[model samples]
Target: MNITSHHGDDQVRIALTGELDMATTEQLRAHLDHTLISRPRLVLVDLDGVTFCDSTGISALVAARTAAAAAGSHLQVVNAHGITAKTMQITGVLEFLTTPPGH
Candidate 1:
């Protein structure tokens, strides 16, 4: 998977494209690690372009949210549709990640 990021005033947005599996989970993790170092108020991961996601990918996402929380920041999984959405739902993180900030 290809991961790109944009640093905003209050939020850091990471966009993912292609499949997110074992082969690509590390890439996402690295990006999240790097991004979290900056301690942005919020991290928004855009999964609209992600075509597939396996358990590893789901774990990476959960890890990201955990990291953000530890840093006193927030992580939001955005535009999760199709298989990606279903995967997040099954993994039991979609609701937490999609919930509005401060909710």
Candidate 2:
């Protein structure tokens, strides 16, 4: 998958296109790591262009979420649909990662 990022004062938005599978998970993770270095208050991942997502991709998302939390930040997936949305929903990961622990 291809990834691009946009940074603002308190938020960073990462946009992903193509397939988010094993072959692209590392790239995604790398992008997340780089984005986290800035310590934005929120990290928004835009999955509108994501056509597919495998288990590894899902794992990567969760890992990013954990990393953000540990860094005292937040992460959210936006514009997810089709296979990307379905995979997350069926795996119970959509709510798991989107919903904060206390909420």
Worst 10 residues of 2 by lDDT: 94-103
lDDT of 2 at 56: 99
Structural similarity to truth (TM-score) of each candidate:
0.95, 0.93
TM-score of 1: 0.95
Candidate 2 lDDT (Cα, 0 to 1): 0.89
- List model 2 lDDT by residue over 1-103, tens digit each: 7788988889988999999999999999998998888788999899999999999999999999999999888998888898888899999999866664346
Q: What is the TM-score of candidate 2?
A: 0.93
Best by TM-score: 1
Error of 1 at 96 (Å): 1.8
Off by over 4 Å in 1: none
lDDT of 2 at 100: 43
Point out where model 2 deviates above 4 Å: 100-103
Q: Which ten residues in a row have the lowest lDDT in candidate 1?
A: 92-101
**lDDT over C-alpha atoms for residue 21 of model 2:** 95
